[model samples]
Target: MAFGTGNQIRTAGRFIRSVFLGPQLAAFLPAVMLGAYWFGGEGVLLVAAVILPALIAFAGLASRGLDLRSPRDSVTGLPGRDHLVRHLDITARATGGNDSQARVGLVIEIDNFRGLQGMYGESGAEAILRQTSERIAGVMRRDDLIASLGNGRFGIAMEKTPRVDLETMIRLSTRLQEAIAAPFSIDGARILVTACVGFALPGRVPDQTGDAYLAAAESALAEAQRSGPASIRAFTRAMRPRVSVPDALTKEVVRALEDGQIRPWFQPQISTDTGALTGFEALARWEHPEKGRIAPGAFLPAIARAGLFERLGEVILFNALTAIREWDRAGLEVPTVAVNFSPDELRNPELFDKLRWELDRFDLAPERLTIEVLEDVVAKSDDDVVTRNIAALSKLGCPIDLDDFGTGHASIANIRRFNVNRIKIDRSFVTRVDTDRDQQNMVAAILTMAERLGLATLGEGVESHGEHAMLSQLGCSHVQGYSIAKPMPFEETGAWIIENQRRICDHPRLPRQAG
Candidate 1:
């Protein structure tokens, strides 16, 4: 009867304490009972029930102590900004007390954080952050405090750092940069990480906030990042820009097409051997009402970012075809029209079906239309989407021209893997060919290879008579450049082609100039 009464009392006490102490203490009832039984005292149960919760609370509080003796990271197992601020304060005071040597702050940012998230997904992004934290920690000294400021950014307080000795610190930063650049395998894909580092000395810091040092470092890092990937830079006041436009410009560009602002300009392509007009390539442009004629350089990049490249392609194609038909009706011999296609256009399965329907509506021949594809798009994936699209175009008697060859990682592979009828040498190699022997040799070899493969070659950026003669001798089938004719409006191109036809028939060798 006595044992039953005691057990009942103990059970009642646990329920009351759980209600008063809440969930964290309620978990300790079993341990308290075991401790009470291990000690040979009937009265010890009452003491243990109270003592266990108190001990647990004390241990939790002790774990969170923010004093210097506490663990570098707080109870959250995350290093707090207070740790960084405390170190900076100590270093500033110590170095300020000495009037000669100065303390410098370095802030390192993980370059392309969003890119990693895009390429590797969220879990991979978090893993990269954790690994970066450990790497920064490993490079840190006992006196040099490090703390995570959130995201993939970290701050460092270099104690008693000297301005003249910044070279050694930069070398250490270089090692960190190289370590990040080294390839990492994640989720069956290889990823390369890079960082932009910024540094500051005492008086050179920004805003005088606790994060001033870190901010200065980040500012320098941003300046370094303009060149891209694994770059390091020191912050400068001159590098800060006054205005930062929002990404809403992409939305403005998307609506530009519906607003009748997006249109095409035609550039003429002439036969290299005969200097006769063969075709015109359609290039997109946006005539912004406010900005005044935004080049493809400005708005095309935004269009690409907004994932409207296919829509852009379709608009250009329809406009070009309409222009070609108008020119044909006006008694201009429209030899052929070439339209460039982005990777997105090739991957779109319905691109061909939509194209065929449009061509039929306009009564245009496939032989008179050429599709210009980038060399980079061919090597992006092994999906065979582009190859299949090219084959379908070929079946329709459409000539597939690989544009910007020798510029990307796999230009030669594109020729071997994809069935292309023409190869256009990138302007970079063509412009330098006359001056550089190696460039000339490379262009000659590519031309010879294309010849053996029975593919027509187009040499772009032929600006001089000598260049034209060299390209013709080298067996380039087509030529397009400023010397021939720049990209112009549809009506002007029609007028120019008529004059060239009259001149070519009259005096075959009379080097024709624009009328």
Candidate 2:
């Protein structure tokens, strides 16, 4: 009775075909028998009845077999891309006149899907794909059409309805992201797959083809993939061809690295209880000749696209270490300087050696530097190189702090695998802690977990005194954000430190302690 199995449906179809054909053949056989007159009436009737029905049944079986083999994804049972396009065309034509009704299309791609498929064999991979499809289907409305675009990509079309405004569509897309990001169990191995989602809204262009809408969505998808895992981007006219930096600018980024034009800006991390400066996180800044000062968001992608991420990291590391050494010589008592490492930089075979070389060059200890890695970076537990590098760094005595902790799906696993020494609660959670009970509870839970794990906690982006006070009460070890101090160049750090010392001494609310 269950239609879940394809074989069962095929069996039922065969039975229905036999029933239809048997009656038609029974009537035809009597006429054939009378015309042929090859035997006595009764004898001819019997022979014709059996022979005709058998022949008709054979034809029906063939037709049913073809229907069962119709174009569909063999694994997920979703329609093929061609069918999706046809459906979109129909919707476009049906709603062409209704200006209020606009069609929205989405393209969802599993990030690093091929790598997952390769790790698990064909059967296991197919199971994951089927589960992913099911999760997506669970979130869609009855009228929304979904299809397999092959190569671990799925397409969705949501026709405009009274309830489905732009905001609703965005919320739905976010739900899809969360759905796919949930952990999966395949062949006794637990795995997590993030998604890159892109959407295209109805455009103003006259008579835009279905392919154009799909093309726009794909363009946005590419942008999301470059941005990172679990990213969502919406297509716009400006994003028509693609989003990219010029090759000349990329080359200049490389030159900037070599010329020491990219420098480190230090943001102090202060103790919540003692109000003493504990450390500084070295943030990268580009001193472009024409641009004057370029933020990391502007040039970091270019550097990564140009495959110069490792070089940029090296520059940042060298500069941070040099600044720390200089600070020490200036009679400043800065305890530690944290430097960020990208996933690619962490996986480099010479990462450990490079760190050691930089430490030795600056005549500094490894403990003086904290290695900050993004939560998503540490989530790649399957990468042996990444895991090994992290272990080596930890063994070398550099504290590993998981940056942007709660934003990622793999926080607990990352902490267990990387032996993290600190967890920096992301600003999103910290910024609203004072106003939102849910935010406060979430921060409380994170601090509780860190305490149990014997790890330190730092509250980032603490722009308000309420947030700072809340974090302090919650037992956060350190705090860093606009409220404490803005990131400044090496030359300005001494003056800022002196100013902060004076202010902390003047204010009774802030407790002062020896550096």
Where model 1 places Cα greater than 4 Å from the true spot, the runs are 1-246, 409-417, 503-515
Whole-model Cα lDDT of every candidate shown, in order: 0.70, 0.78
lDDT of 2 by residue, 410-458 (tens): 6576788897999998775675476667667778888888888999999
lDDT of 1: 0.70
| Candidate 2 lDDT score relative to the true structure | 0.78
How well does each candidate superpose onto the true structure, as a TM-score? Answer: 0.52, 0.53
Best by lDDT: 2
User: What would the TM-score be for candidate 1 when compared with the true structure?
Assistant: 0.52
User: Candidate 2: deviation at residue 195, Å?
Assistant: 24
Clashing pairs in 2: none
